[model samples]
Target: MTDTTTTAPAHGVTISEAAADKVHRLLVQEGRDDLRLRVAVQPGGCSGLIYQLYFDERVLDGDAVVEFPAADGATVEVVVDRMSVPYLDDSKIDFEDSIEKQGFTIDNPNAQGSCACGDSFS
Candidate 1:
């Protein structure tokens, strides 16, 4: 189940509490303070654009950041450029374990279609 208690920012985008917890768990396991999940929009994917998910230790000079405050009040930041923010607005990052899929997934509201392998998106 997703965490539903956290308040959304004035902006339309919001992250579920469950997603925040999952990110926090990963951050704790990684044992890195400088690392955060960097979500970005790239030129190619199955669709016209793709979402990049990775680790970053440094915040660029003018990068936009979306931070999900952990249940314990610690914050796990999700950095995405301003351009990508609109496409990913109200999107949530979730963790799942199943026979077919096991990892963090982007629950993006703006993605109309995804690649066959689910690596890229439009």
Candidate 2:
């Protein structure tokens, strides 16, 4: 289920509390509040498209910005470029910290098929 808190943005994408917490910790570690989590789709993965997730300080034109509340009461901003909106609309981002897996994961409903590595989508 998607986050329905007041901090949730009008943007279609939703970031789980766990993911927001992780992002918050990362930002604190870098001592930079200017960074925003940027999610973009780039070409050239095995399935023809790949996900690029990183912290960006720049806000380009036509970027969709969303603010999610972190565990510490601070807000974590998630940015998605206009071009990637269609590909990531309604997508949910989550963080898993388990023995089997440990990292951020994207549950994109728009993805018709993803590569075996889960790094690309068509």
| Top of the candidates by TM-score | 2
- TM-score of the candidate numbered 1? 0.75
- Model 2, 1-122: lDDT tens digits are 22324454545789999999999999999999999999999997889999999999988878878788898689898988889989898999999999999999999999999999998999
TM-score, per-candidate, Cα-based: 0.75, 0.92
**Candidate 2 runs further than 4 Å off:** 1-8
- What is the total number of backbone clashes in candidate 2? 0
Clashes (N, CA, C under 3 Å) per candidate: 2, 0
Worst 10 residues of 2 by lDDT: 1-10
How many clashes in candidate 1? 2
Off by over 4 Å in 1: 1-13, 71-73
Report the Cα lDDT for candidate 1.
0.70
- How many angstroms is residue 70 displaced in model 1 relative to the true structure, after the best TM-score fit? 2.3
